[model samples]
Target: MPILGEFREFIARGNVIDLAVGVIIGAAFNDIVKSLVDQVVMPPVGLLFSGIDFARLEWVLKPDNPATKANELVAIQYGAFLNTLIKFLIVSWVVFLLVKAVNVIRRRDAQHPEATSSAPPPQEALLMEIRDLLKAQAGREEPPTRH
Candidate 1:
């Protein structure tokens, strides 16, 4: 099909592959940010909050009936939400910093390359005019020689 050929062309262009790689790296980085939040950041936060362990912290929306532990699910996982929120913020900050740094370097490279080089001016019009004048002069000389 024409569509399949077009899709193949699109995939073969390398942009899709680059995007796939970026997604894979982003997923891996997410785990790193999660670890940083749970392991490093939350401990100090827990100490600040009178030694409350974030993981062990949760609020029960529906209290389980003392008589039965059946069908007693609850809601509002604030601690996990809080921890995840912190992780998101850290990841966003890191991504922002990375993008900012990349932009700065890109701007710098655009302004000043390793060795700045200038392009020569185009001389097509001038060359064409000179060529026409030479041909005209040759035509005039040939007529005089005939006379």
Candidate 2:
């Protein structure tokens, strides 16, 4: 097949479509999680810690001076790191729960095969029967082999 045809075939695959959808949904979910962490979760937690704003929490290595010719405020932003860490933990926890739920569902399906049986369809079963009958007939009609 030509390269364009092969590319079209690849793009038409179910897994590729599924992956595209997953990426789009994941991006949206990331935004939601970020909002939840930055706005909803952090504000309440900050209130608990004496109104400490994590995003602004930093260790100042060099304080800004107005008199110096080259004055710059250098700091390590540990508070922002803490906020990011919390967001990571939250996202990981949610993913863990989702995976756990999926695993439980898979286990249940596995334990009860009758619930989601993969037995051959009627047409396939009939084709298999015909194949077996042809094989038997072919064997019976074969000439006897010389010793």
Candidate 3:
């Protein structure tokens, strides 16, 4: 019972909830970026490179076994490695763009907050009224009025 209560308290924390949400969203974002790279970026680039198959790019680490066919020999997947590197770069660029967009939105919101339509809080209004009254009283009670 004590352990369950502690676990419940920990799970209810704002930071923990936020972190869990971030992880879920981040995974979804990674999938979108991967799809964009594979579908949008790689095809055009591959076409530009004389229709080269990026994934098939490789360096034979061991001598080719012509007897067992090319499929039988072990080869280092340098092309696939290159493809992965390109995918990494694309994902990073996309994440950078997303962060930049978020920053721009934050800046815009800071400049023009949506809540500007609301009136000042009651406490602030009271403080302002008190300040104005004090200024008026000071003017009325100056030396000419007091002497």
lDDT of every model, 2 decimals: 0.86, 0.94, 0.84
Relative to the true structure, candidate 3 reaches a TM of 0.62
Q: Highest lDDT, which number?
A: 2
Task: Summing lDDT over every window of 10 consecutive residues in candidate 3, give the lowest-scoring window.
Answer: 64-73
Give the TM-score ranking, best first: 2, 1, 3
In candidate 1, what are the lDDT values of residues 1-147, reduced to their tens digit? 699999999888888999989999999999899889999999999999999988776777888777886978586778898898898899889999999999998898888986445543469767888899999988878454453
Residue clash pairs of candidate 3: 57-79
Which tens-of-lDDT digit does each residue in 1-147 have in candidate 3?
A: 699999999999999999999999989978887787677777898899999877787777777667874566578888778777887897788789999999998898789887446789999999999999999998888476454
Following a full C-alpha superposition, what root-mean-square deviation does model 2 have from the true structure?
7.3
TM-score of each: 0.70, 0.71, 0.62
Model 1, residue 107: what's the lDDT?
Answer: 92
Backbone clash count for every predicted candidate, in the order shown: 0, 0, 1
Scored by TM-score, the top model is 2
- Report the lDDT tens digits of candidate 2 across residue range 39-131: 999999999999999999999999999898886999999999998898889889999999999999999999998988887999999999999
